[model samples]
Target: MYYLPKELFFPSVSLAHSSGIIALGGDLSPERLQLAYKSGIFPWFEDGEPITWWSPNPRMVLFLDELIVSKSMRNILNRNVLKVTFNQNFRDVISNCQEVKREGQNGTWITNDMIEAYCKLHELGIAKSVEVWQDEELVGGLYGVDLGHVFCGESMFSLVSNASKVAFIALVEKLRTENYKLLDCQVYNSHLESLGCREIDREEFIEILKVEKVDS
Candidate 1:
């Protein structure tokens, strides 16, 4: 649990300390935040709490071509009850994610500062949102950053039952259409597992990331 300076570049921090938490107590500036994601690091903190950076050890990710679409999920896909759109409503999606309360999680880590930071990322065309629309209203959505062919999924929320699932399927379809190579899920969870996310070592993730074309 060490602190990092705002002026530090991508090379300043070491990946070997992904578990030790190389940074803590820093402002979520657009440049710092952008650089953080590019280096596979992210911030997570509660309301009124210090900005805490983290890079988990055993990361969760899914190769776009390797998603395990179960038979049941395939049936859900066939129904096509909902339609999906990219960057349709980023503000709404993030707000929803922040408001949707879970039983155990202490309040939301998606604080006001977090919102503004991701909004800045969205403005730069780095962070994106995928909204699931049913008829005329938004039911579910997810947001993340698009780095080259990889989509680093951040958060998702559902207003209606099964809406999140719809959004996810739509996201995969969009990724396929766009020829995406992977979706970095950050961490593992049963919910993501249901949606076909799997685990890959952090080293492996860095290896794949290293080969990506750097944005000019």
Candidate 2:
């Protein structure tokens, strides 16, 4: 296992282990996190564990043009039941994500420190949140770091049925209209698959990230 130095440099993603952890023991400073995302590396670790960096093979991603909206979801959208907004109540969104219970998960990876770190990233305009509101109450939301051409989704929460899905679909539509290149989901799962996110080889994903940048 490789260990990171104090400086904000990471080893090549190719050197990552089969399980995708490339290194450990890096601080979540804004500079480090920014460099990490640019290199297709991200941090994922429990609260008691040292920070671990990963660059998984067969990365999960969504091409904006290929997003799927099912008949039911389309009907739900037609109802105009949920209101979606961006960068509104970001701190509340992250806090709610930290409390959400996930199936087969005994705990959450969104540690307090992680929340603070991402919030700092948000303040710097590097992270963003999607909020779902019903009757003026926050019901669901999602948060992630925006890499200009890509949005690395971190976590989401829903208080009502299909609320998170609504937030995700809205975000996808917004990204598509904005001409973004890809949505870096980072890993594969049935949930993301239903939303048209698929697994692509690491090399291809890295290439897309390189070519998909917007002017700063």
Q: Model-by-model lDDT, in order?
A: 0.78, 0.93
Residue 133 alpha-carbon offset, candidate 2, angstroms: 0.3
Tens-digit per-residue lDDT, 1-216, candidate 2: 988899778999999999999999879999999999999999999999999999999899999888999999999999999999999899999999989899899999889999999999999999999999999999999999998888899888999999999999999988877778889999999999999999999999889878865643
Clash-forming residue pairs, model 1: none
Best candidate according to TM-score: 2
TM-score of each: 0.89, 0.97
How many clashing pairs in candidate 1? 0
How does candidate 1 fare on TM-score? 0.89
